[model samples]
Target: MSLKSSITGNTKVLCVIGHPIAHSMSPIMHNAVIQDLKLDFVYVAFDILPEHLEKAVEGFKALGIKGINVTIPHKIAIMKLLDEIDPLAEKIGAINTIKNENNHLIGKNTDALGAKVALLNAGFDIMEKNVLIIGAGGAARAIAFSLSKECKKIVILNRTEQKAFSLARDLKKIATIPIEGKKLNEQHLKQYLFHSDLLINTTSVGMAPNTNTILIPKEWLSSHLFVFDVIYNPLETKLIKDAKEIGCKTLGGLDMLVNQGALAFEWWTGEKPNKILMKNKIIEFLNLKQC
Candidate 1:
C-alpha cells in the first residue's frame, strides 16, 4: 500500500501481461517487494488479448517500461515480439520475463530457474533421481529441459500420446539421460509413480474452480514419492493434499511463482528483493481472496 504514496511521473513501470490477468498475484507480490525495498518502480497487471499483443509490446517499448512478465497466452507469442531472446528460453520455446534496455527488449525464461530453486530449497535433490512429470505443456517442457542433465530419467505423460512423444523427442536432443513420453493412463501412471523419486504436475487439472478433479488416483501415490503441483490458487490443491495424506512430501506453486518473479525483479532492478516478504504477501492476498 505504501507504493501508492511514491508513484510519480518519474517512477519506472513494471507489469505482468496475460489474457485473463485478474487472477494473477504477481502485482501484489511484486509491489510488496518494491515498496519494502523502496524501489522507484511500480508493478501492475494488464489483460492484453491475443490480438493486441503486438501493439501492447510496442507500447512497452515506447513508454520505456522497465520490464514485463508474460503469462498464459502470451508467453510464447511474446517471444517473437522481443528484440532478443535468451538462449535457454529459446530452447525451452517460451519466455516469461522481458527487460527493456534502451528501447531494446530482451526476453528470458525464469520459470525453470524458479522451479529448480523451489525444489532445492524444499530439500529435494534432482541428482540421479527418476522424475515423473504429468502434462506436456509449456511448464512441463521448461522443467524437463532444466532438469534433464541431473535427473537419471525423465518421464512425461499426457492425455495426448503424440504430444507427450513430441516433447520427449525434443528433450532427448539435449538430455543425456533416458527421457520417455507415454499416454496418461492407469498403466503408465502406476509404472512411473511406483518408481519415481519425484512427481511434478504441470497441468491445470487441480486448479481453482476445478479443485475437485485430481489427475492421479489416491491409491497410486506412495509415501516415498515427492509431489509438486504447479498450481497455487487454492494454496493446497487436491493433488498436494492427497500427496500429503499419503505421507509424501509436497510443495505448491506459490513458492515457484515468487521465485520466478524475484528473478525477474532482480534482472530488471539489479537489486535482490526480499523473497520471504514477497511470498508472505502472496499468501496474505490469496487468503483474503478465499474470504
Candidate 2:
C-alpha cells in the first residue's frame, strides 16, 4: 500500500523541523520503519523559519504532533519554546529530540548518548581514552560534554580559536577531566592527534557537494586512533577513508544518525523500531555504502 493511502485522520504525526531541511534524511528512515512496523504514525519534514518558530510551536500543540526531531538552527532555539527540558539537554545547551504528551513538549538531547552507543557497539570504550574533537559547534558540544565525564582528557580544535576555548571552559566547569581548546591548524592537529585515542570530526568539512576537503592529513592518523566523522550524507568521508587506509578503525555518521533516530522513536512510541531497516533505508536513499 502507498504511504499516503495508509494514513488516516487518527494517525499520529511525527516530524523534523529545520531551516533548509531539504537535505534531511529523517523522514526517509523514520517513515520506512513506521511502515515496516505498521505503526499508526506518519513522519514528515518541515522547513520552518526562525521567525515563525513560535507560531509553529503553537500549531504543533493544536495539531497534537506526537514527536519532533530538531536539527541545525532550531536545536538551541526550540529549547525555550518547550514545556520542559531534560537536565542533560539543558547542560549541553542543545536538544535534537522532543516528545509531546498532551501538548506538553519535553526536550532531550540524544546525539551524545547515540554517539557513545555507536562507539560501544563498534567495540570501542571511552573510559580513560584521550579524545581529539574537531569543531566547537552544537554537535561537538554535546559529544564533548558527554565524553568529558568518562574520557581521560579532551582537546577541541576549531577555525575560530576562541569558540573552541569557550566550549572547553564550559565543559571544565561540569567535568573534572582535562579539557583544552586550540586553533585548528596543522601544528595543533599533529600535536594532539598523535597521542589521542579517538578523533571525532564534528565539522562540515567533508560534507556532501564539498566532500573533497579533510581536516587532518593521512600521515597524522595512527593505527591506535579510531576516527569518527559526524557527516552521514556521503557515508564514507575523506577522513574515514584515510583512517581506514592507515589500518585504523573508522566510523561514519550513519550509525549515529540511526541510533539517535531510534532513541527518539522509542521515546515517542514506546516501541523499538527496526534499526537495520531504518539504516538500510537511509543508505538506499543516499546510494552509498555504510562505512
Q: Cα lDDT of all candidates, in order?
A: 0.92, 0.91
Please, what's the RMSD in Å of model 2? Answer: 1.9
* lDDT tens digits, residue span 1-291, model 2: 255556888999999999989999999888888888889999899999999999999989999999999998899988899999999999999999999999899999999888988888988899999999999998998899878888999999999999999999989889998889999999999999888999999999999989999878898888999999999979999999999999999899999999999999999999899999999988887884433
How far residue 247's Cα lies from its native spot in candidate 1, in Å, is: 0.7
Q: Candidate 1: deviation at residue 250, Å?
A: 1.0
Model 2 error, position 28 (Å): 1.1
The residue-by-residue lDDT of candidate 1 on 170-250, one tens digit each, is: 998888899999999999999999899999999999899889999898889999999999999889999999999999999
TM-score of model number 2: 0.96
Clashing pairs in 1: none
lDDT, residue 167, candidate 2: 93
Stretches of candidate 1 exceeding 4 Å from the true structure: none
